[model samples]
Target: MKVTKEEVAYIAKLSNLMLTPEQAEKQAEEFSNILNHFDTINQENLTGIEMYSFEDEPLRLRKDEAIPFKNSDELYANTKSMQETAIKIPKVVE
Candidate 1:
């Protein structure tokens, strides 16, 4: 699955890319190598492989606990504009 210069040019044109002659040649070589790697992988034998959706063991998650913040007012003390409980930003559209 070799990518030719003409193929690279066509791809670049379709993608709306501005590629120099050198860049196009380099990209073609890289793309060809990637396709060759995929071809090599397709030649492998995986007769009894188990597909994994998650880790083998169940994950231990932390218990949900409410932790009170100390000096919470300091976080919003430097705001230029704010409501009673939230920061305010200017409207973008009229």
Candidate 2:
């Protein structure tokens, strides 16, 4: 797989990052190299590998529980605008 400058620019835009032409080019190359490394790893063969397991019994897990925050007002005290519950911030996405 290869990474393009346009793809880098698009990702930067989505992440609210300002990258110069040089930076974008460098990022694209770096991303392409990283992807190539993963590709290399994927090409390895493990045909004779043996599977390892600790236990056959079903695993036990703790019950999921909902715990509410103690001081919600204090949490929202520093926000500029609050619409019912969520704090409002500048829209970064188009």
Candidate 3:
């Protein structure tokens, strides 16, 4: 499963990637090494391995509670400017 320079170049072209000759050669070597690692993994023994599952654990969630605000004056006290009942911010777009 060793990746060739030509294969890498073809893949880069298909992906619209602009790679120099040196970069393509380097990427090809990297891809070949990765494929070799996968080949090694495929030869491992896993006869009695138990598949991992997340169904046994209970999900801990916080209780949603409603807290009341003191007043509008207290909330808007730190604003740069304010209209009748809302905070006034500078215009961002035309």
lDDT of each: 0.87, 0.91, 0.87
Q: Which structure among the candidates has the greatest TM-score? A: 2
**Tens digit of per-residue lDDT, candidate 2, span 1-94:** 7999999999999999999999999999999999988898677897887777657877788879888989999888888999989878889898
lDDT of 1 by residue, 12-82 (tens): 99999878999989999999999888898678897888777467688789989988877778878998888
User: Model 3: per-residue lDDT, tens digit, 36-70?
Assistant: 88898778898888898668987778889877787
The TM-scores, one per candidate, come to: 0.42, 0.52, 0.42
lDDT of 1: 0.87
User: What value does the lDDT take at residue 69 in candidate 3?
Assistant: 85
Where does candidate 2 have its weakest 10-residue lDDT segment? 49-58
Q: Report the C-alpha displacement of residue 49, candidate 3, in angstroms.
A: 14
Tell me how many residue pairs clash in candidate 3: 0
Off by over 4 Å in 2: 13-18, 46-64, 77-86, 90-94
